[model samples]
Target chain A: MFRSLLFVPGNNPSMLQNADIFMSDAIIFDLEDSVNLDEKDNARNLVETYLLTTKELPKAVVLRINPVNSDLVDDDLKLLQTRKIDYLLLPKANKISLFVLDKILKKIENKIELKPTKVICLIEETKSVIDIYELAKHERVEALMLGAEDLTSELEINRTTEGKELLYSRSRIIYAAISNKLIPIDTPFTDIDNQDGLIQDCKNALNLGMKAKTAIHPSQLETINEIFSPSQKAIKWAEAVLKKAKELNKGAFQFEGKMIDRPVLEKAKKIIEKAKLFELM
Target chain B: MWQAGSKESNDCLITLKKSDKTKIKIDSIVGHLFHNQILNAVKDTLKSDNINNVEVLVEDKGALDYTIRARLKVAIKRMMKDV
Candidate 1:
């Protein structure tokens, strides 16, 4: 149910204190790329302490830990064993990395009384894009996030504002995620100052069936949330369609000179459900 | 000598030095209101870790109890490594 997931550097006390205050649905306490090697231990300790002591938290608390192969992964998993984390965003995720992480999570679950943390697999490499369906089917994977910056670098192409280069990968990811009934999160728009660009980017992702989006800065949350939310017109149409169906009491009917069948009715029902979940109704 | 944390707002810089007896000094922006609480945070962390015979200097910028404890824990671990 995360329309917007904001990234917060794990070691910054100022940001950590206000993590839940932002309007974003979830906060990703980043312990990977945002943290330097020298400050890895400091970030881990800081995030752990924050989680343990903070009584009020955001709707969802996600931790983007170091890569699965890194030595820091062991310490990163320790948080799951002791603290309350909702999701683990695995960077540079692949089959081997997911296998290793699943095994580790299993071990932790056996030793503790805690529920297993959900996983969000970051799709950045070509191999990952190719194997996305399999990755999406993983029992622990709840979402699939497209990391455009890293994926572009791997492809040796400059990512343009038009995002033509990412169309194929984005489509594949969206399809796989939807087919598996998982949430597909779009990459963050890096240009913090360009509100117009952010709006267009969010629209493009939404049109392609992306359910959620990531935000590098808090400023982008408003636009992302607005674009991804079910529009007022759509909600009204859905409500009208449901009313007509109830009145007709028929499998197939005519509404506004268009054929309304079971599939269309189901789609209308889904829109109303989304509107209610997002508090738009 | 070992140190952890930073001088940023809502954070504290902790410095540790080997000594004959344990001593703690706190210099914080919110010292007037939370001086004893800050001292207890440091003492409780040290006691829980079974650390003694060290000098701790906390330069705090309104850090909370958990933050102070985290910084002190890292400082203790680094200091013990050299000992």
Candidate 2:
């Protein structure tokens, strides 16, 4: 359901304070990958203020903390115990056993003394691709973000402006996320100047049943959000399908003079679901 | 801190400067940033208390320590009260 998630470097207090103005569907305060090793602590402390002082933050707030294997993971979870942190975004998560996730979940629950419901896992490695279905099945997992940087590292493939190299991994992610009813967020398009590349990636994600994507810069958010959203034509088609289904008294039917089977029907339903996010339906 | 475990260091950076009724600078903070996780801890500390700010700056490494935030807030509050 997150139509756009922007990653602001965890160290930048200004970006954290003003993140709401951009109005992305979600904001990722990155403590991994983006931050220098020396500045991680300062970055984390700065985020705490942003989390506390702001009201009605324009979107869902997710903290992109370092991987569980990293040195700071324990302290990060400990601090989150009493604070009103949102998603626990674990990056570089590959081949995770339920034990690992459950352990982390327990730690968070004990600290904040709250039930564990929110978690976003980054699927960024080839090993993760094999275990994606199982990873998606984890009850606490609500969203799966495609982390191309690591994906490229694991696969030994380079990403191109056209995004052709990511096709297989992208497809597998969609299949896995959709099967588990979890939201799939696409990888960031690093070539910020290539407007055409971002648009193509968003279109591909949309075609594959993805609902959102990550952005490295604020400027990329607009194109990604717009492209991934339901088109007016799509919204109209969804309305027509539902109307026709109601009239025919059947779950399966035809639309646009073609058979609209379950898959097609579900696709149509998704259109409405996504459209509802923008209040179009 | 932003991550899970570490008792070795404070995860944040803290500074106290007299307003001197001078305009606050945006770019840098004078107090040194502790190694690695210190910056994150300071930033995370922001949630624990309120800040009135003379001026505060944080550079994230990989960890956000809570003490960093707490120190900054206490410093800011003290500065605000003195005014």
On TM-score, the leading prediction is: 1
Candidate 2: residue A110 Cα off by (Å):
3.1
Kindly list the per-residue Cα lDDT of model 2 for residues A197-255, writing each as its tens digit. Answer: 88987887778777789999999988987887888998898889888887897766767
lDDT of 1 by residue, A1-281 (tens): 77999999988888888888998989999999999998888888888988998988888999998998989998988888545799999999889889999998889888886687799999999999999999999999999999999999989999777888989999999999999999999999999999999988898888888999999998999999999888999999999999999999999999999999999999999899989988999
Write the residue-wise lDDT of candidate 1 on B1-83 in tens digits.
Answer: 89999999999999999889999999999999999999999999999999999999999998889889988998988887888
Question: lDDT scores for all predictions?
Answer: 0.92, 0.69
Per-candidate count of clashing residue pairs (backbone under 3 Å): 0, 51
Which parts of model 2 have CA positions greater than 4 angstroms off? A251-255, A261-263, B1-83
- Let me know the DockQ for model 2: 0.08
Interface RMSD of each: 0.7, 8.5
* Second chain TM-score, each model: 0.97, 0.35
Tell me the DockQ of each model, to 2 decimals.
Answer: 0.76, 0.08
Lowest lDDT block of 10, candidate 2 chain A: A92-101
- Quote each prediction's TM-score: 0.96, 0.76
